[model samples]
Target: MARAGAVNYLFGTRFYKMAYVEFGNPAAPAVVCVHGLTRNGRDFDALAEALSDRFHVICPDLPGRGKSDWLQDGLAYQPPTYVVALAHLLAQLNKPVSWVGTSLGGICGMMIAAAQNTPIKKLVLNDIGPYIPSASLQRIRDYMLEAPERFGSMADLTQHLREVHAPFGLLSDAEWAHLARFSARQVLDPTGSGKRIAMHYDPKIIDPMRAAVPLDVDMWPVWEMIHAPRLVIRGAESDLLLCETYERMLKEGAEGYVVADAGHAPALMDYESQARIKAFLLEG
Candidate 1:
């Protein structure tokens, strides 16, 4: 059920491998998807299938996550490098593409949209914005660092995700199973347990935070600079994207909507959310 491919980007002298999934016709209009922090490209499998008939969907696992190659220098995992890597990915397609970014992914689209002569035609920012609350960042930091290294079974991993990500609103059992299938990779079990499942991403991906200093940067100007049509999907109780910022995004002409009973980030797995995105993309 999974159809993913890899591409290599030569950064300086070394090459980095990026993993992404594609669905639908290549000749159709393209939609480039990016996942949130600690998540891989497979997170968008549902959304990709829903939109595939009308759009060519590309969902990438940012470096250090999913099937993508990990970085030797953790500092290079910043948004700017991601933007460049994505641009290269799209350039290979030789066509402009719409963007759907969630959390850290949204910030990548913002940076690319603000740059000169970019290929982003439309943007979807999911539960994130310029003024990221440091509180949420700290929460993410502590949680990832303390998460269990691996699970004895896929069921165990799914259960862990259920408790930790309950704020993504209620997902059906099938949905959770889908997530668990992609979230872990089979590895040689150290305890000779016959190939236990481990998280798919590099644990060192958070190393940048250890040596980082705090800074507050206003992103109103950059947000304003983007000319493409935008849609902002906010989880009702999201600690990431504030209501005030969502309002400002609306004032700046970006369409806005809320996914009730959700928090932090709304996973676009539900019917209502996919339908809204479909309508926006098809708006006349």
Candidate 2:
């Protein structure tokens, strides 16, 4: 059976929605898994399956992505907005929650978890941390700042993924097809040309003071505020999460691990990555 679910909630005067997948008993210890930029809750499917029996896992699609409703104003697609929405979601659950966030989601978790007396009991940052490299951020923005482009067929989409997400490494043709279908949603135009989802987020979400210049934001204060037990996973070849950041985490006494043959992020499907995360989350 499909383990997915969704709930609607309001932010400010605007109404929005988010989708989640639930697993295990409601009364059990809870874990929240969030997806990276341009991805949805569905990205956690494999990892959720592995943890479902042991914990109450809920993976939510963030606003402007996946099944979540797009804001009438795309400028609202910032980390602070997501943190507020998630605070409401956790209040709905009415329990202390732990978090495992990939990429953008991880950044949100860090901000929330660092707050004094925050509800997040433990944190697992998958392929993200404070002090994101400018080069990696620019690469992500380059893709997000563009309007959804159409492809002739699944093969065309796969080629796009290969060039853009080469860090994800080689997948079989079938795997590429599976990802392409989920990442795209049909547009309502008369001709029915398909469009990439998350089309609602404004391309200028992060406008530089001048065009073509990189934007930089420092997050060391937030990183230092983390109080709960934390685990950070970095893919060995990742452009986003660097070795230096991982080493600094180790120096700060946070648990750290690296995955092989992966870049930017490693899907929890990797055996070593799963074991490292599972062990951290299960620790008493």
Candidate 3:
């Protein structure tokens, strides 16, 4: 296992604590792995550990998720705010960084890399593409809305993760347990009865999705603006990354990998998936 540490800092003027886990040597080249919506930084543990030998890995729990501070105003969860927060993180690194992002995290990567003079040197966008249909997006939002914020027991939380994230494919019992452990927090059960567990993220992290009228936005312009070397990962069964758009992205000169037996997103925890990402990032 690679050496690791937890670090936190105050970003913006809100004093919201931005937390992250760092792996490998600080002197090595950097790689930043950002997680999907409703998921936190720990999602990258396996991937980070795998890459730590060659790269310094940083996995940040975007505000309102995991160990990071939650925002009082849900509206602050928008992409612009997230982009600003990322800029702050990159500045702190004081060096160019490679990025690995899943789902919402991928979208965040696109916005940052599309900007003028971005610090992102290379990028891996997992299970997302330049565009997704409105209906597919609505389905994602609906599922999130249905998820219970608090669980009565570890069993309840693990069961819920299994159902919704079944697309992660066949993970070992230990893998599932790892997710359940890091994905939740023990909190006062509100009923004043002992304690219950709640999902680690702020429920309002989905506010932006809920508030918007669903529309199929054209993201090719965003895709085109990115000049860094890039790779796009698509789940074989993903509804969010349309086959047509993904193909177009590849034809547009970006490299792509399709993960088998997965949908919506690839967790990047499996060895094969990690190998694909590793090869892309390490290529000369």
Candidate 4:
């Protein structure tokens, strides 16, 4: 195992905290892994552990979704908010960083990298891009829009996770348990709220984004602006990243990988997915 630590830093007047977990020597070149919407830093645990030997890995729980503090307003959960937070994070790190971002995280990467100057030196966009389908966006909003309610036990939460994240596909009970544990934080009482607190994220974050979808905002100009090496990974069954979009990416000279048995996103947990990501990140 690589040496690791948790570092928290402020983002704005709001005092958002990002939990940074390192998996290798501090001196090693760094790769930062950002999780999807509704996910936290722990989502990268397995992947970071696997790469610890060769790279210093930093995984941050985006505000409102993990150990990080939730925004006072859910509307603050938008991409512009995240992009600013990321810029702050980069300034603190004080170095060029490689990025591995899934879904929402990937979009943040796209926006940042498309700019005239970006902190990222290389990027791995996992199951996301300029174009996202309305069906998938609607599916995600439907789940995110739900209000939190009491569940009798962890078992109930686990079942809910499985049902809502059915796109993640069948996993063992143990896997579901792991997902449940990291997803919800105690909200009940001092001894700990047996009642789960849905990590505070405003579902309204996706509203302005709705107009940008169906065919997706013309992020193509930004795609052309990125100078860093880039690799895009799409789940073969992903509804969000279309085959046509992937082809457009290829025409733009971007490299890509397709993962089987995944949808919307690839966790990079499976060996094949891991191999693809590792190779891309390690590329000269």
lDDT of 1 by residue, 36-64 (tens): 88888988999999999899999999998
- Please identify model 2 stretches exceeding 4 Å from their true place: 146-148, 170-174, 189-213
Model 3 TM-score on a 0 to 1 scale: 0.94
Q: Model 3, poorest ten-residue lDDT window?
A: 1-10
Q: What is the TM-score of candidate 1?
A: 0.95
What CA RMSD would candidate 1 show?
Answer: 1.7
Error of 4 at 201 (Å): 5.3
TM-scores for every candidate against the unseen true structure: 0.95, 0.88, 0.94, 0.87
Candidate 3: misplaced stretches above 4 Å?
1-13, 192-195
Q: List, residue by residue over 90-193, the lDDT tens digit for candidate 2.
A: 87787888899999889999999998878898999988988788888877877755534555555666677766766665456665665666676644555555
Mark the regions of model 1 whose C-alpha exceeds 4 Å error after superposition. Answer: 191-195, 213-217
* True-structure RMSD for candidate 3: 1.9
Once fitted onto the true fold, the runs of candidate 4 whose alpha carbons sit more than 4 angstroms away are 1-12, 189-216
User: Could you give me the TM-score of model 2 versus the true structure?
Assistant: 0.88
- How much lDDT does each candidate structure score? 0.85, 0.75, 0.85, 0.74
Q: What is the lDDT of residue 158 in candidate 4?
A: 78
